[model samples]
Target: MTNPSTLPDFDHPPGTDLWVFAYGSLMWNPGFPFVEKREGLLRGYHRGFCIYSHQHRGTPERPGAVLGLDRGGACRGMVFRVEAAAVPDVLRYLWQREMAYRVYIPRRLRVRTDQGDVRALTFTADPAHSQYCGRLGLDGTASLIRQGVGQSGRNVDYLSSLIDHLAELGIEDQGLRELAARI
Candidate 1:
């Protein structure tokens, strides 16, 4: 494994030391070649159902909320250390994958890892552009999580995987738990 700190400086030409934050699908599939992955934390930001689905993950006609890093609490995810030479190609791929929703706005974030904290680029919800499912209560959210269908796949599977992943990490989400129980 390459030491992220030792990689050639990307600040000049190649743009080395590129770090990416993976919250949802990216956690399981980054779709990029990375040198290292570490369990990391983002402070002052927590995952929320803030983004409305369009085409990327779900159909625009029947949209749902995907995870996004919103202000408050903390977010636990993975940090990917990518090669500088691969930044452009990787970024392009991400754009293509994420363009459908138009809910995410890429930004630089601070990631805390066992090695150390690093500033990395990550995508977050665009409040003005994203769909806030605040009206959806526990039952409604659980029902949506259990039965909604999307382009990516079934909403149940998506929620299941997220719940399972978080459970494996010893993180409990009451909303997710209720959804799982309903299913």
Candidate 2:
């Protein structure tokens, strides 16, 4: 796993645009400015409860499960187009917010959308990280989410918010839906 600070800063040629793929909280709260957004499809990675949050959603005593883009299948998410001038600031914020613990790998991946294909900055799951929870079953996952709380508030709120946003996008995540129902 690479520390976000250790990674070189993101760079783009002048006039080149920046794009970001939002599969989780980012969809609801991007925390940055973007020129446009569209529904997008990313292949080879799907959202799953693969990370145990030790800061935002739960504590070390009883970790909460958070969504990560694990390998396989495909993910339907939002792609945000950012102006070139804002790339540096946006990348800095995203690095601090999503890469604080190096639980995710910062990558530029291709996403297909109604607007066409776009190369977007995306954070992918780092299975090697200590926080990785692997493939915990739904019931076990739900149980943890039910009881977990951290600086960000209740884990159930996180799950429910994601479910609501996915519903608004007309995207169905059966596992998450079932888990949300149980919660």
Candidate 3:
């Protein structure tokens, strides 16, 4: 297996099949075409706001939070199966959208799919970057989730979308649910 620590070359040649793991905005708005999508879980990693939001999901004047993969827990997201011929174009789109945060380091992630686990490319937080928010307590997190009008739209929308998606897959995030109630 290729080392997961190294960054992926987004500019792969044509005919290379690409699998992308979507955890946040990409989950809801992939902004790219894919041949298939499946419910997948990633181990040894979880979703958090390790990256700061300055645009897209947040504004420079009133920034909002976006997702950054952190080194703990398990994350449930969608695994996109892209056609080999479209790998280069699709990857470029993903890189443009995800790299907006600039604090993320793209790496290969091991995702558990229905067919079994597969290695896929995904973005994770770079600890050294200034955008890293780290982990937040429930209350602190709820506050941001409740008021989501800064850069990336409403915080409620982000949480609600994730909750809805999880429900569709019969999965639950107790922490997120509890925080949503408070919101």
Best by TM-score: 2
Tens digit of lDDT per residue, candidate 2, span 1-183? 333335644344546778999999798789999999999999999888889987778999988889899888899999999997887788788888888788887878899999799988888888888888756777778888988899999999988888888898788888687788787
TM-score of 2: 0.88
List the candidates' TM-scores in order: 0.77, 0.88, 0.79
Model 1 bad stretches (over 4 Å): 1-14, 54-61, 130-140, 168-175, 178-183
List runs of model 3 lying over 4 Å from the truth: 1-14, 57-62
Q: What is the C-alpha lDDT of each candidate?
A: 0.69, 0.84, 0.71
Candidate 3 structure quality by residue, lDDT tens digits, 1-183: 222223454333346677889887677688888998988999988876445466655566655566678888998888898998777677667666766546777877789998988778888887788767666666666665555465456767877887887677666776567867878
Clashing pairs in 3: 50-132, 52-131, 57-151, 57-152, 58-151, 58-152, 59-151, 148-154, 148-155
In model 1, how large is the Cα lDDT of residue 164?
85
Candidate with more favorable, higher lDDT: 1 or 2:
2
